[model samples]
Target chain A: MTFNRRNFLGVAIAGTAALSAPRVLGQAKPHVVIVGGGAGGATAARYIAKDSDGAIDVTLIEPTRKYYTCFFSNLYIGGFRDFASIGHTYGGLASDYGVNVVHDWVIGVDRDAMTVTTAAGHSFGYDRLIVAPGIDFVEGSVPGWSTAAQNKMPHSWKAGSQTQLLKAQIEAMPEGGTYCMVAPPNPFRCPPGPYERVSMVAHVLKASNPTAKILIVDPKEKFSKQALFEEGWNKHYAGMIERVGPDFGGANVSVNPDAMEVDIDGTVEKVDVCNVIPAQKAGHIAHAMGLTNDSGFCPIDPATMQSQVDENIHVLGDATIAGDMPKSGFSANSQAKVAAMAVRGALTDSRVFPAKYSNTCWSLIDTEDGIKVGASYQATDEKIAKVDGFISQTGEDAALRKATFEESLGWYAGITADMFG
Target chain B: MRERVFFALALALGGAGEGAADGHAEAIGDAERGAEIWVYCSGCHQIGPDAEIGIGPPLTGIFGRRAASVEGFPYSKSMSRMGSDGLTWTLTTLDAYIENPLVLVSGTRMSFEGLEDPTERADLLAFLREYSDKPSNIPEAAPTARPDYPKLSEETLALVGDEAYGEYLSSECTTCHQRDGSDQGIPSITLWPEKDFVVAMHAYKQKLRPHPVMQMMASRLSDEEIAALAAYFGSLSN
Candidate 1:
């Protein structure tokens, strides 16, 4: 047979017809319903739809039309990134990848029925369900502080307007005033996040109020990349930041939002600004679906990210007790790819690859002073465990730090594109 | 007659012989496989039209070209000196260099540990060849002088795999590999080919691979243990 342009065009037209035959025949395609269109859900929805070549129906349920990444919201607070840079829409997921992006809250899940009922009264049936609800703050973790008092003492952990509110509060602080941060207990989203936030807060305060003192009340003695953060705090914002550990009345803390007073073991301290990052658990939907354990996070099979509670459902990102992996956006995005692959294989009988995962958390300290901690991970029978890891050493030269910071900017762009598209 | 003429031209161009070319024709180290291997190189190097300089120079038209020739790219002193000393990229040279960059030029700034698997290197070379100006002239065969890996026998496959045992052994593997299938700078190892898994572990164990941590980890595993891991990871659906 002679292969000419006419012949190729004929074959191409025939191929297009063959590809569209299923839809033309009105055959129902397998549906993948993803809840919580954050890094995990959005990525899974995109990958499944893109890779399946329209054979799988993908639906993404997110309450918000636009997503504000908690990853670099601290940069927004520190004035490194604008609020617009952190915000992303699902238009690309909808238009580019053919995902049915539904802007509605997932109210409940019927696992036996393999369906999800949204707050808008829409029900989505799925061959596979991915839950990536991210995190929700534990109510009243700090005494006299709740969601109602968030306006007074902005948690600002979830990004969005609260981040803007906190930024405004920090910028409005009086000269030589105090900015107190009540850090959360262990196993929270972004382990180094609170520290990076403190660094960003200091970065902002140093330029505006050089005499402004920042205080940290922490429950844990050591945090992620403690030495690096402490060194940065001392080097860049020395005499401006004070961290109070449990030994020094860091723990045993309570707050009064009405009076704007923080009591550290009955020691009342009135501050100009209070950034309370309350203790957190998996988002409410996880609890409602009975996916979480006593630790308030979902347990999963490391090999496939299938929930230990139910094999039909998978959990990703900050919501899962992810072995050695931290609850960061990077971790969540990584898990989403694996989950997507597994879901595709389960639904479409595609080739499945072994699960390999990696995550790196970059923290910016002042301008061009960036540090990172990262590791590669593989799935063992027990859990996702860390392999080797690396962190930027203290006292590194400015040039190297600048390069590291630049690398992080590239990563932010790359990861955001990976998630949204 | 066409195959004979192609082989004759390939031989005249100092490419691979018929035996090696025929092996590649069977798809052992085809361009498609090479593209998969190229993901490792993509971190530093780029190829194809419109490829720009990254951490490493763009590798478009690299075949038979002088090393460090791309303008505006900052080459290490050693690389510049090597280029001046008559270093040129060819299938053979690339095969050697990619296997161990430091060995080829001791002070070169390219920090890639190098492709330890000869098949993977051949695959990458095949992919890179396509981006060159004279792709047809480039070799399509695996290099003659290459490291030999221990073959996994049918007996080994039948005897070694115990999913439970493999899972028990994989705790160390998961340390660096996120079970959630995320790729940081590190590549994910989920659902890897069982044969590829065994070969790679054996390479690391025998000190043929360059990563210090992998070498240490591989050194501790026995053949059965490695096979068991291969089985466990191969069974994954992610």
Candidate 2:
């Protein structure tokens, strides 16, 4: 649809709008640059570009040549699905949405000049900038956790090399070898994610090496779907999965990477394989550019997704402090659409409408069994809070579990379509 | 005669589509448009046909069924507790309930600010009537008997700090409570009969509410703030 002159001018007069029609159309469509093409930024680019058509020039700068999702990475570890199934290409974005996909890491953003500088030394000027650069692992939190040691002890938090490395470690372990996992603190990437990862890994251990044991050194006593997880663990895995919470001597205070051992409650235990998902914060570039606050996350208006720090910049997905919503692909996808709508509203110079976001997390316990927790969020004056929510009741209904599996796949497809296609 | 027949045929061609009689005219409802209307109800009830029930039981078949007829959906202890509460839901009863359920049946679980506009209420009632089972003839039950509860004495009111200041502080509670009293899982605070509302607020302040989220919220407010919150919620129509 062609931009109507009257509607464009009316929106511009609103002053809060992101793109003034004359200014947007007068020169070039105001460049809306997005950093990171994983879930959030890529989706934003696809949506804003498509909605604006030729009215907004959208550029997506992501370091990765190809994108691999963390959603079904657990299935790969369990040997249920291959790595190929979860991996995706940005071709759909470039070809279908006409998004300018640039394979480069953004180093910094000059808020004053509104230019984003990349590691490759290319500076793209933008009328509006969106950053959704996921999370960075805090290596030094566990005494021995570092990049060098990550090869032997993988975090597998970001899903590509780390996932493969951890899977290989699990395969190489002897029949009776120990598989230890360290779950991070709350407000991390995904709340129920670590538990799901552990559950999936345990499934592999039970199938290949029944005698092998899985240990979780957890920081929190209560976990998401604790009752359902315990029931499944007992019924399916049986003697395979063993958990150690804060009550037990399982609190991982430190680790010795070289020795391949973790120190818990002054006890040093050596393990055959270790998957440490460490504490995380907004990606480093946002920090370097002074976009993050003391909380290590950027604060933004839930309605507009525009940073409170700098109005010119909008942060979506895992990078921003979106309240009550966890960092998941689904959450990111939902937030991206809201942010894109806001950007569109701003460009046209109109009042941006309020947004409601929905997040659903599905955890696969067995080949066919899965559990889900979901909530729909609304933007309040101060924060985003749950307007409606649900947890899977305790049961082993095959129909529900199967439906959840199919819905999870559909969710991924729909979200991907909303972003790139 | 030929020209007149041709003219009649031309007029018929232009406007004849409206005159065709159909038996299933009412059965074929506008589900697409109905989906948009579903937004108004979604605050309390999940509109999904298969969606698991939330706070106010599922409305999958509220259309033509008797009011509060969903089995397994635990009716309010107030309604069930009232004993022999013969409230058969009809279009008129539903319209009245939408305007103000508390006014219609004082102790009912529904605490919604009834739809004020007559036409809108009728449309919503028609929408509900479209899905209900058999229409039944029954008179709306008399008002629920109010349980005896103690009111705040003058001394207690004195203890609650300044009254004027409390009224000013009640604005924040509206973040969750819209004027129409739509909510999911959360009780519509507006419809609370004053005494129960006051007691509940005091209980929350005293750390009686099971939830830490509510307890934390309650602990922060002062005695004056509590009174103001109570007054604001009491003023709201559920």
Candidate 3:
């Protein structure tokens, strides 16, 4: 317990390390640059800024000023929510949390120099970087469909105007017109999204055009919450929606956007409206930064969300191949906090706590009918391992289902508040 | 009779008259209004004729009953300690618990967020009273609820939470319960009395709370972790 000669030598070496820290040297506070100011990046920025209390410089760079969440965009199509309700801004992060909100696209990153270059030509030097650029469609993943043809057959997978366009097309269809969807393959954002979208589309048509039909062409053999979705479909929209799985050649499909037609395997069918959600990859910025792998998703250390490729860089949200956690806003928001805590502890000597992650996905089938699946996870040596979970059961009483639906609304408010503020 | 003595004691401590038993439970609050608020309690407490121990000890006879007296109910260790110390429930005690549960028994596992509004607490208590043995000679309503053994065991409540650690642990909770105390469909958990917060969370951790999401979130928290979260969130203002 005494500070003897050996302890004195150890103290001298530790003192050198402490002096090198920017906070100790009275230099500019350690700067943290975050990209893709959506759920992950925004929450990371907010946490770091709020926790550090001016001890760290947090700069959040994103191209969009108004971020629209993809999680609830389907509810908008079904008319359960207004378009404006899903959109959030970074003003809160700037004013309340003291984050530097830069509304510009990132052009490049010089990792060795620890600097980020944006299209505006501004350069930001950082002690730590967090990338959470979400997802981008794989070019030509669906034959005859690309961003060029997006105006004709909208993807609506990324939300924003594409979602509005898809909803408009579905509404404008003739009385007996067909609405077709080419769903994405395995490991897409929002696992229950495509089926839920179909449910919402059918909900609108059941009121406006009862004779209208909805068709789904999914490449996956099965999906998250398949039984629940199927039960709800039969109970609410029976005879109105149809799905063709990989067994039925759903994977072997293409579309002609101009002609408004879908080619399922060898059969060509005419449809009034088509929505093609293509194969996905980590957002382009992740690729540009050389962080993603052949899996088309960046791999990260499950414990800290640190990039496997770059020690100084951390990746979050849908862009990262988070083991066991699905690509959802809740997952992104959860990952961001761990990254922020690690970042703060690294730069500011803040207390580093054990990493915990959890996710819950809620989907609405029809009026007053909602379902959810959730799990709590702990970081194991291999991955973010699931510890416990629960899902809404089939044939649950109407009141319970209604409560779950209302809970989703509260979660929306809660998560967005967690993100934006 | 033991029952007679406790009832008279309850009336004396509560400071109300027997006129409350005829559904005019004004000593606590309107029993009628409490029925509407019963939706909040029914998930755990299942009172009235079919009362049964579920997530919590049934409130079948919560009023004037000793703490944790329901046999076969899985009471928390600390709650069992309080019950063993001769802590009995009266209208005043029920009001204090419903208003802020852990104030009287810090480690007890009744997970309900204490009803903040006094009238609401009174109504909820009156609703709970409907199942208890009828009032005797006087209305049992005044603010005299006191635990026979008031102080918590030093060993059980000794862990002083690290605020920084609590801040990090609270990230999981903030996903569904807002930090700013905004209650949409989920109740706001911010700015609770630290002891009350610990009890509410332990309720979930012990599988006494009903919501799946909250139960899952709470199940994995160690005791110190829950204490830390309680400390940090407790420091916030509503």
Candidate 4:
């Protein structure tokens, strides 16, 4: 019960025999325990398992039977794609790569012991633990948007259930009904995501209920893909979508769901349906385990994703305070691979390579065309720096639009394959 | 009907058991192991025993299939353009693309983290061969966050909510080039559109925007952590 440092390798090594485990696990192999089955966790599992070649033991702890990716959730809402398109399973990690998959939410972490305690009350010790469980909403950031209230005014930031609820509200609203969206200030997951959501929703509204309108209460004046998104909105939706930036009383200060109203600055406005994406921190487990500081996120050694306070534990994905980078699925997957490699190197006392990661995001402007942005990165002696990247340019080139849309699909296939495949 | 017949003839000549033997080197993927790998592919790809269109183009017979050749699927114009330009999907080409899709085809629509293991790629290719003769089946799983790990943690988080800290952060960033977006070597984070800055940073943190250094910087902030930093710097007059 008292997870000690010595127990780290022992615990990781013990869980190696669940499924498609390789026949030869070298004695010198390192041990890794990964928490979260999303992009980061799954990628780490695959690379570490494949690269280590049976030398490392990987145990992944995740609660969901299936994961619904937030990347293309906007597309689903836009009716460009369906929900099933972005959903994934962990069978590949279990069967192909020989990872031990546990279906349980992590409840706590015993950092000193290098052990992770799950909600099932089972504790798994690891020589190196990588945590990439994504973000958790910060309660009271918006006055009335509690976890309970979130059900009423779904944040849907986590995808799945919330996505359905938001969709349902949009569907049920009358032709002229008003839909209010509370956009988080900044540094949240998927920076361009909410705008994309609105774009998709507006597309749907225009067709199904022509007079329906969207009111975005943004704390900031601009957003990702601004010109391109505006171009699409103006050209397509016309007058259906209106955005209120900080300059226009969009910096909302409070929410009163009982009245179905959100107060921006000091003004309160009632709406028919509300979608409030509250401010967030690292997931509950990271916070509860003390991996996080007052800011409600974890701090780790950037090069290794190893917790600064606890080196044996690696905090990754949206949970860590990596500067400049956004919290996204692609970044999480890249980090997972790096962390897995680092864990393997550390366990076996092999040389750990310096890290490099890449990301690309495609925003669907319409059913036919899409916009994109991406960059590559490397670690220097002092910090992480971008090497190369690009964003889809403004204006519609039929070839570029079609190319972007197709590239989006390829990217979805490629990443999901990398993670789960 | 004509397409199906041609496909059948191609499968016969390609040799389903041994793979395409017309000097177009096929990958040496383990079909058995590849079958297991297919589970992950099913999440986003249309991969069953046979060819069936799913979230992505069916990978029923990808080994010898032309690049982006699924029928009825809206091919990215970049891809169709490539096809129009006479680009074909040979085994080697497929291998290169699988290693890194973006790099292999810059304008291609399939943005994926490439398969790192050589053997696994070969095996998956072999397994895909089995579907060449059967109906195509690919499962559609939604995509998740892309992977990116941070390269620094303590220093960056300490800079959160502090504009004065930009001097310190800029010290680390300036080594590559000037701080303004006008820098020549690396694109400048300074002077970027506020939304672009926030979203780009978010992408870096989530590992969707992959790089060693950016992942490192992005990994160190919380929501308030990022917002505070974004606000602090975004408010600065470039």
Candidate of highest TM-score: 3
TM-scores, each model vs. reference: 0.66, 0.62, 0.77, 0.63
lDDT of 3 by residue, A253-326 (tens): 98988888899998999999998999999999999999999999999988899998987799999999999999
Interface RMSD to the true structure, each candidate: 10.3, 13.9, 7.7, 13.9
Native-to-model Cα distance after best TM-score fit, residue B65 in candidate 3, in Å: 20
Per-residue C-alpha lDDT of model 4 across residues B1-238, encoded as one tens digit per residue: 3444344334433454444333222334445566665555655576444657766788766654656667788776546655532345544555556655543344456656678676776666665655554312222111122121222234543444545333323323332333333322134345543443554565466554333345555575455455555554566564
Candidate 4 residues lying further than 4 Å off, grouped into runs, are A1-29, A349-351, B1-79, B82-238
lDDT of 2 at A10: 46
How well does chain A score by TM in each candidate?
0.93, 0.92, 0.94, 0.91
Clashes of each: 21, 19, 6, 102
TM-score for candidate 1, residues paired by index: 0.66
lDDT (0 to 1) per candidate: 0.77, 0.66, 0.81, 0.67
Best by lDDT: 3
Candidate 3 falls in which docking quality class?
acceptable
Tell me what TM-score chain A of model 2 achieves. Answer: 0.92
How much native contact recovery, as a fraction, does model 1 achieve?
Answer: 0.00
* Positional deviation of residue B82's Cα in model 2 after best superposition, in angstroms: 35
Query: Candidate 3 has which clashing residue pairs, if any?
Result: B14-B142, B16-B139, B17-B138, B17-B139, B18-B138, B18-B139
Clashes of 4: 102
Cα RMSD over interface residues, candidate 3: 7.7
Residue-by-residue lDDT tens digits, candidate 3, B1-238: 3443344334333423444435345656665666667667666666655667888777776777877778898887556544543456776556656766675555567777767776776766766665676644325635244222222345546678878789898898898988777766676778787876776676556544346787789888888887898889977763
Give a tens-digit lDDT track for model 4, residues A1-421. Answer: 0224345556545554332334233335455788888877887887778767788788999899889988888888778877788788898889988999999988776655556777777877566778887999888887777988876788989989788788888888886998888998677888889888888888888889989889998887888889989988888889988888988777756777778887888888878788898888998878776788877778766677777677778888889876556678877876776677677666664445557666666788777677877776666544445666667667756655775676567567666776776
